[model samples]
Target: MAQPALGPAEAEGPCSTPLESPVHPVDEKPAPSRLVPAALQHIAAMYAGVVTPPLIIGQAVGLDQAGLTRLIAASLLIAGCATLLQTLGIGGFAGNRLPFVNAASSAGIAPMLAIAETSAPGHQLPVIYGAVLVAGAFCLAIGPFFGRLLRFFPPLVTGVVITLIGVTLMPVPVSWAQGGDKEAADFGAMKYLALAAFTLTVILIVQRFGRGFVRQVALLIGLLAGTLAAVPFGLADFSAIRSAPESLDDQDDGEGEGGQGE
Candidate 1:
């Protein structure tokens, strides 16, 4: 009653293991030259998205220039802190130690605007803040359960959600192409349309033909190229940079004069 012979794989026992996938060099710590551009590319990709929420809310709340500046600064600081915490997890506490950029979510804009509209003048922001705090706490409380529930979302559902998001955001680039201001005299100028078309073409070309980091940063490259092209068409304005310091100085002088008079 001899036993049957074992298969080749079983004969090798536990020592026989599948070969692990090789890691590409680009996945590792890149050179300084590559790293800087790659980092700048990520910044370019998310910069507008990161600032949009605060910009819209600040305008809606009637914040002054200085106040808007502070809001933007604070938003950037908090996002940076959150990104650090996420990448460098605390001891048995917050963060998943992943590479993620945390910023003000555009998803909350509608609800925030509603809250602002419902609140009294000069009190809208406070109400919005209170609501945000409660929402944050609620999210924290349900974090574990929420993660568990994600298992119910199959790839089909996830793909549909992603497609829906892309569809929803399709108008953003269209708005940008229309000069970003509906009231502008040349809102839908042919030049702007051409610029957008050129940018999209560049992005497509890069994605199709470029290799390595170039392909990875195609969107950023397209953005930069479009900006450069815009300058020649009088679409890129640098007047704000020149006026910002003067505005700050004027604000400071006004404040000082008021204090002296008092």
Candidate 2:
């Protein structure tokens, strides 16, 4: 009643045939058409965060309008390169290759402004840059060894770190919504709160009800909506950019003086 055993070729044939991988939604690569929009959305989300740091620190260090513009352009370029390195990586050792967006941290603003405050008037920016260079070198040198400490932080401890970061940053939004500077007379004005609420409501509505690309670009749309809304209230002002110099040489004369230095 027992069947005869298969030959070696028959047995090996079944084993040698390639097994197909199961298609998983989670592992699926998005089409290039859809991929671009997804990336832009992430850029939209992080744009303000990346731009604000350079603006704040550059102004605090007493950069002129021309110098501030150069700082902002440099910041954006560096952030883009950092993000690419983080997501794509060089070989296997350099980058995390995660879905993370790397940019300048707002957390450093206080320390940097403190540095600027202690420095002499015309010398502040040079000192701040030197400090930043030294700090960056120290961080890079310690990174490999410091990564080993990750094992010491359980989920609870990690959660505490996140909570502390959020708690510390919570005041920044409150200050922004109250008209930026805490010492200003209009620091707790109702107009700013109303503007912020209106912007939030518009963003939420677009995100919740919009379909396809509308939903994807809600942040950008909300910003446009908010700017238009601000016009009636006289809150938005862009006079500085309106008065920008005609030529690039004049705009960034500091760099134009020398052809290209080492």
Candidate 3:
């Protein structure tokens, strides 16, 4: 068979030997950068976050200054320990070193709030802890079964659950927009609305165009942005521990003891 010769124009165009398909680069995983800055960032991010829920719940329960102060401290300490356990996993007991930072899960928030509201006529921390212990046991007993049944969840069921979760969480954004507490005198105030709007805008912008690391951290960025924006309006309180009288502390202790006796 006779081979056809290429046209002069085609022959001159970049040596035309099929161009070796341009040798596209393989998507190799990038080497991890130094851990010092990342670890510091993780710790700082987690430390500030793990204390807020207890503080809010304490306030909701009408705890006097001292009682709420202790609650906040305890929450921070426990959260720190939980985070350490997660990041530096225990052999068969606790940890799972997966960039995991443990904090209070939002799933428990509503139930805990209910307990805080209905807690027997006095200090509710003990009751809350007791209930948490029970709930944790319940989860531990069921979690493995759920894990084993992972294959049972097909795409349809996963989609339904995800849709339901989104629907359920819509109220959280609404509540935050309305200042986070239903009973607050300024609940639903303009300041809170503005903060929520700013956060939503930032997230939307990120989702629309952000790439790589910026896209990955968009939620964290939005949260921080919302928090910073709220600070000037008295929404993000980072005041150092304020002193409370010993009498108030003793009073709570007495109430707690009395409630336990009853």
Candidate 4:
């Protein structure tokens, strides 16, 4: 005898199951219009950090203006290349293929400064380079094992490290708020403090009220706003950029004469 007609739900088969949807959607690539501004924001955020190391080291090594310019250019080039590699990655061996800014590390500053102080003036940079090469080799050797060690760093340890980093860097912003140079006539002036406070308030307001991309680029907005605020207080200076080329030209001429004498 034929069975009664089955309903649509049962007609497929007893084994049939509904297809499950993904809990989270994959991220889509952003359009060029959206990407350019985002990229600029990232660059603005990291620009100071990438340049500061070269600036400090160049001065510490007594590099002439031309030499310092070359050092700055090289630092920027290396940082851009490293950032590209980190973001795009090569084969499986290099880079994590994450959104990371690879720049001259501030961690090495103290060691590099120590090397500069203890070594002969002519040998200081070479010694620092040699140390860097050794450290790179050590890191390469330990790369595989390093991932395993990360499991030991639980949330507590991670939090402590992050807190310590913030604590260590706190003095930097304080110095900026005090007009950078402790010996300057305007150091710790009320005007500088007010400008800093205005910048901080702007940042907080943006973070609290701004939406989407505006919120994401809040730091950059804060920086631009702070500079504008400082301009009215006579704190924003453009003399350095105006004189840089002339200084470099003079240094190059001095070096040429010194080379002829040698």
Best by TM-score: 2
Backbone atom clashes (below 3 Å) for every candidate: 0, 0, 1, 0
lDDT by residue for model 4 over 209-230, one digit each (tens)?
9987677667778888999988
Q: Answer with 2 or 3, whichever has the higher TM-score.
A: 2
lDDT (10s digit) by residue, model 1, range 119-209: 8999988899899999999998998789779879999998987676556556656877887678899899898899999999999999899
What is the TM-score ranking, best to worst?
A: 2, 4, 1, 3
Model 4 — which ten-residue stretch has the worst lDDT? Answer: 18-27
State the lDDT of candidate 3 residue by residue for 111-142, as single tens digits. Answer: 67678778875757678889999988998788
**Which wins on TM-score, candidate 1 or candidate 2?**
2
Clashes of 3: 1
The runs of at least 3 residues in candidate 2 whose Cα sits more than 4 Å from the true structure, single-residue gaps closed, are 1-19, 22-29, 155-190, 196-223, 252-262
Can you give the TM-score per candidate against the true fold?
0.67, 0.70, 0.58, 0.67
Compare the candidates by lDDT and give the number of the best one. 2
Cα RMSD of predicted structure 2 = 5.6
| Candidate 2: tens digits of C-alpha lDDT, residues 1-262 | 9988988767676545446345455546789997887788788767777787888777678687788888988888989999999888899667887767777787677777788889999888788889889998998889889979988989999788767766755665677778876788888899999998888899899999998767866777888999999998899988887888777777567456555562
**Runs in model 3 with CA error above 4 Å?**
1-33, 44-52, 64-69, 87-89, 97-99, 141-146, 153-176, 179-187, 207-220, 223-262
Error of 4 at 160 (Å): 1.4
Q: Which of the two candidates, 2 or 3, achieves a greater lDDT against the reference?
A: 2
lDDT of 4: 0.79
Q: After superposition, how far is residue 141 of candidate 4 from its true place, in Å?
A: 1.9
